[model samples]
Each structure stands twice: as structure tokens, then as C-alpha cells.
Target: MLWIPIDRSLDIPLIRQVYQQIRERILNGDLQSEEKLPSTRELAFELKVSRNVILEAYDQLIAEGFLVTRRGSGTFVAKGTFLEKRVVPNHALNWRENKTDAANIIDFRSGLPALDLFPRKTWAKLSHAIWNDTSHSMFGYDLPEGRPELRQALARYLLKTRGVACHPEQIVITSGATQALTLVSRLLLSPNDTVIMEDPITNDIQTIFKTTGATIFPIPVDEYGIKTALLPENKKPKLIFITPSHQFPLGGTLPIQRRIQLIQYSRKTNCYLVEDDYDSEFRYEGPPVSSLQGLEPECVLYVGSFSKILSPALRIGYLVLPLQLIEESRRLKWFSDLHTPSVEQLILARFIDEGYLERHITRMKKVYKKRRDYLMHCIKTTFSNEVQVFGYSTGLHLIVEVTNFHFSKEKLKQIEQCGVKVYQVEEHTIEKDKHQNQLILGYGHLNQEEIKEGIARLHVALYK
Candidate 1:
């Protein structure tokens, strides 16, 4: 092990500092894969730090994928992870140099939880109780289909809350909705099968769709969700994916009549509808929009996640599948990590069983409703008639159409620097320049203070 300097005066602990250094080294290729690392005691003594500090650092490294420990064989650097650190002279970071700088600025990004307001105390109590009850059985490998109790609880939640029809047997748990989409794309889609998607949705999903080698057809979206009128008649696509429950970014709920039409089309076309119910819980105008999965279960693959409502880190989500697709999805899930963690599922089971989740959703609904109202009020008070916000009734975000102002990328960068952030509608489009005057503002995570101040700064950026 190399000697690492310990900074006693820094607020960060020596263990964390050492961990970061080693991780950076391993990621950079200073340390090769499967190479033996120095023992904790030896490294501690050599670096003149306590042995416990070294052990703690190693523990964290192991928890992440930085290092692996073998019983009686000592720890070694992780393989296939040296890219994070190695520098190529001419290479430049292309993803986003502004990620760091952007993070430092106040954010208005969508699909985020209001972490400051979640009921941690109540969740802790349920978690502790679940641990006491199932710590023994949870130590073994779990069912690939996920924890039975959580599935059962989710079944009840769907019936009462979302009007979805399904039993626990048809429900499969995965890491999150992203994983759900990945496996669905793999299982249902053949190499050249066609996928019909909303033209202006999150680019993150595009990665998964493209990797499947599937032919993607981008259908146009309007204020009433995906325009059924614009759906391609010639392609006969294999599957159609939509965010019907308060369409992402644009925030329009697919109306019930349109949902029925989509369902009818799915049945007639023999195609599956991947309904991503991402943020339907926080609608400020009224009760949550009814899911398309309710219209037709066989044609609709309903997906939901607790990321926005509870926390993203939970990494727990459910998919309601038709019986025809259930076995294939289970097999895909088995190959994809076998199953999700049982302890968290067990805790969530108890959480829902005892009505904790319902309570949490009710509480969050009020919190987000208030935030949504404040967002509307802020737009009305600050920008007034200058900016027109779309789909303001439901979901976490609203689409602001800047009337007569040039909403250029350079202007957006300036607005980002001015301490407010938003999604460029143009980026979501397959073709550019269509949504030049539009911006998607997410207000779920921020409180009254951040929302007000962020919008005020945004106004300064806009008017200037």
C-alpha cells in the first residue's frame, strides 16, 4: 500500500480520505485489477494512522465495487474498474463538464424526492421491526420474483389507489423502473422489433431502447399526451411505451377517452403498452390520474416506482404484467441479478402492511400539492403573462412556454449559471428546434424559499 497523508484538521475523517484516494487510484489504473492490497494493520502502521481507520476505508471500498475480499486470501483491487482514474493525454470529458458546476447551483430537475420532508422516524420504526422478524431467512438467497409480502402489499395498493387489476403472482419486483424497462425491452423486443415512444421523453430511456437494437419510431406528443392521430400506421410496431400518468416533462395526463383508444389500439394491433406511471402521486389539482393499465391489463405493462414518492436510493419498484408475459419476465429477472434485496422488501412489506406507505403517500401528496401551488403562484407573481406554464394541474413539473423570447441553448446555460435549472424540451425531441420556446420546470424537491428564489433568478436570466 502507498503511504497516504492524513489531514487531522479537515472535517472529513481519515478513513474517508484514504478511501477516496484508493478508489481514485484503482479507478485510474495506478492499481491493477486482482492485485493484492496491503493488509489493514500494515497500511495503518505505514501511514501512521489507526488500524481501525484503514479497516473502515477498506469496508467502504468493498461495499462499493472498488475492492473484493476473499476469506483467508486478503483483499485485492477490483477488476474492470481502472478506467475511472487513468488519464489519456488528449482525452477530454465530453458528457458534461458542467455537471460539477451545475450541481453547485440550485437545481429544479424533475423526478426528485423532497428528502428533507420524508418521515424517517416512522420508516425507521418499521425497518427495525422487519429486521427483528426476518433477519434469519433474509440471510439466504431470495425468490427471483421478489419478496412475496411486498408484492401482496403492492397488489392491494394498486387495486385501491391506482385502479389496476392484478394479484401478487402477476407482480414482479426489480431494482427500479429503469431496470423494469431494461428487462422488458430485452424480453419482449426482438432485435429488429419496433418500439413506439413519445417523441419528447427523457433521453435516459433512449439509451436502453437503442442498446436493444430495436427500431424506434418517435411519435409526436401534444397537450393530451401522445397523439394517437400521429401514431404511424405502416410500421405495426411490436411495443408502445408511454408515460400516460402525467406525461414526463410536458405534464399532460392522457385523458380517459384517449387511454381507452390507446388500449383498443394495443389490443387490435397485438402490441403491448408500457405505461410508465412515474410521478402520478403528486398531482396538485385533484386525485391522481387513473392509470392506462386499468383500461386493459393484457395490453398494458404498468410500471411504478417509489423513487419520487419515497426515495430514489430505495431502488425498489414493481411491474404489473399480463399472465402471458409473466414467466418470461420472471426468467429475465432471474438472469438479471436473480432478485432484489429481501431485507428492504421485508421492511417495505411491513411498511405497506401496516399502512405506513399509504400514510407517507398521503403526507407527500399534501407537501407536493403545496409546492405545486407555490410554483404556479411564483410564475403568476414573477413572470406574470410573460411565461405560459403547461400541464400545471398534475405531476411534479410544468412546461413553461416563453412567449416571444429566444430560448437558445446559450441562454439556458446562462439561466443555469444564474442558479435555476430546467430541462430543454428540444433535447427530448428526436429532431431539433421544435420546442425552442419551451422549458420543463420541476418543483417537487424544493420548498417555498428555493422555488421562489430560483424562479426570481431565472426571471433575471430570461429578461436580460
Candidate 2:
């Protein structure tokens, strides 16, 4: 006999409850394919439910294809109803444990900020205030772009800090830089559309663009940044993606001359440019550069995120879109997620409005610069004239080019066996051979002592 338990107190109707449970059983493979279910009369008697209720439940299941009924026989479980279960291998679990829980391993992975220094108390206070104090309407479905308060706060903050000229209406809050890039790719590109990107770009960035069915044109980057002169003349691309402030892995800042050329190229070719100013806030040595969007707001779609400065878990980033693309992007955002969470948006807005974000950035800049200096000092002391470091003095990471050293998988495994975790820059490169001897060292998450010790361990791992 089928165990059919019906609760009269449940908000869900009795018919729906029965239908859902049976469907779950079928999908979970508890009910074998083509197995006959108990007759309605028997089920109704077993549960003490009316014949009408049992009939209704069985009818729903039959209608939805969870069960099939033959006129002469009984209802049976549908074939092909069971879902495939996900299985995790033991070795994969072990790898994850070692990567996450192993002690004494110092990681120099890029794109991570100093999570230890985030102002938790202030953030909690703001979050509490927003939750308890804000209106009930805030908890409900709001605008697709974002909460108005957060968008307004972002407009003011961007203008004051990065010189990005934009109104609150032009801002669209996103989950993070990843979503921002995704929105742009979906809206702008069609299948087979051509896009120009830095040669050794981040894997996620490359994947997102590729998923749009776009063909990528890889441009070689140097110590000065993307070689703008080498962009194919007369070959008009649909879009150009760049990390101008600090190039990923390579750490080169695009020169003003090249930036101007890019803007002019965009204007002449009528192609859009995506300026991902991911870590422009952490410039240690030079004056902070303004976003390219400020130069030609109509031609460039600027992307900014708090992941590097605040916490990546915040899932808060914004896109300052061109006037023409505003409505379409917002519509796409609506279709994708409706909106970012209202509570988080409210908390971030309060954080920015109350000046907590600025104060935090100011304090962290000094700390990060100190850490950067220590890492640079340690590398110079250990390697002497044998190594050259690129993408230095700014952002969270640097690229070290060691003479005659190739970070093959076996070599990386050997380094890992020594309890140090450093990444090869070649991992991000499209043409891996070009950056075979270089490694990307992100120092933002590590302290001064960890930086020194990690470098020493790496040296020992290589030469010992």
C-alpha cells in the first residue's frame, strides 16, 4: 500500500500536497518505472480521505505525466521519470580539503583583496538599520536596475573618486563585475561577432565572451599594456574589451596616448569599448587615473566593482551605461535576475552615504601598499638580478618573470609539495608559450610576514 499522509492544516491544498509527494517519489526513483500505484479507493480508505480528494490528486499526477493510467488496469509510475543524481569523487573531495583547510600554505592568487580589514562592525550596524528601519516595500520586488538610493550613492561616489560623469538614472547595479560583463556581452554581441581582447585575459572573462558565440581577436600586451598600434587596421570589431587601469596578470597600465587612440578608434569604427576598471583604487605610486568612460561616455561602457575593495561576497557592482543602451540593459537585467537583493543594496548605500566606504578604502590603501613594498623587497632580496617583476606598484598582484624557469604542471606540483601556493601567469595566457617563465603573485590577501615566508618557500621549492 502507498503511504499517503495528508495534513489538513497545511496551507497547500490536500490535492497539491499528494501530487507533489508522489511526483517527488517518482523523480527520486523511489517509485520504480511502470510500477502500479495503489487504486484511489484503497488510498482513500487507508488515509481516511474522501474519494473525491484521492481522485483529484491522482488526476493531477496523471495530467502532469508523473503517472499514467490504463482504462482497464491501474495507474503506474511514468517511465523516464527519475533524475540523474550528482556524484562527487573521493579524490576531488580530498583536493578541495587540501586547498581549503590545509594549514601553513600561503596563497598568492590574484583578484582577492584584504578580507581581514573589512569594517564588519559598521557593515553589520548598517545592515541592521536597513532591515529594521526601512519600509516593508523594500523587502518586496523593486526596480530591475537597483535600489534608487544605491544607484544615487554610486553616481556621487564614482564622480568624486574616479571622475566618471554619470547620473543615477544611467547606473545599473549588477551582481559583480562578472555579471556586468555578461550583461554587456548579451546585449551587444551576436553570433560570429568579432571582439578584441587582451591576449592573456582571465579565464572567466574569456569564457563569458565566448559563451555569447562571439569570435575573439587576441591582442598582445607588453609592459606598457595592450599594443594599440598593432590593432588590425580596417578590421572593424563589434566590441573591444580592456582592463586599462591595471592589466590582469601582466599589471601594465595603459598609457594616456594609447587610451586616447582607443577612444578615437572606437569613435571611427563605431564599435563599443568596455573599460573594466576593476582595481584602479589601489594605485600605490602614481596618481589615480580617471575611467575611460569619462573621456567618451557615449562610446565606452564602464564596469566597476567593490569586490577588490570591499568583499567579493557583497555581490555589488555597477555599470555606467551609454544613454542609448540604458533601457535595453535594464530590460535584460530584469529578465536575468529581476534585481540584486534589496537588503544588500540598502546596506551598501548606507555604507557609502555615511562615508564608511571612503574611510575603509583610505585605511586599506596604506596597509596594501605596505604589503606590496614588503613583497617587492623580499623578491629583490631572494632573486637578485635573476628575475624581473611586471605589473608592480599597483593593484593587488604582480607578475614575476624568472629567467630560465618554466612552471610546467610537474614543476607546479613540486612547488605545491613544499607548502607554498603560487600561480603561473601562463595559466591565463591564450598563447601559453609567450609567458612560460612568468608567475602571477597576488599579495593583497597575505600579510608582510606571509609574503616574505611564501617567497622564501617558493625559492627553496625551486632551487632546493
lDDT, candidates in the order shown? 0.85, 0.89
Q: What is the lDDT of residue 58 in candidate 2?
A: 89
Task: After the best TM-score superposition of candidate 2, give how far the Cα of residue 360 lies from its true spot, in angstroms.
Answer: 0.8
- Alpha carbon lDDT at 305, candidate 2: 92
Compute the lDDT of residue 124 as modeled in candidate 2: 90
TM-score of each: 0.80, 0.82
For candidate 2, what is the total of clashing residue pairs?
A: 1
Q: Which candidate should be chosen as best, given TM-score against the real structure?
A: 2
Cα lDDT tens digits for candidate 1, 205-232? 8778878888888887888889887776
lDDT of 2 by residue, 1-464 (tens): 98967899989987788788888888989998999999999988988888888899988888888889988898999898898777978777765345533587888888799898889999998988888999998878989999999999999999999889899999999999999999999989999999999988887898999998998898999887899998888678889999888888688888889999999888788899998999889998866788878888898899999999999999999999999999999999999999999899999999999999888888888988898889989999998998998788678999888999888989987888887888988888776688889898999999888999999999999899
Off by over 4 Å in 2: 1-101
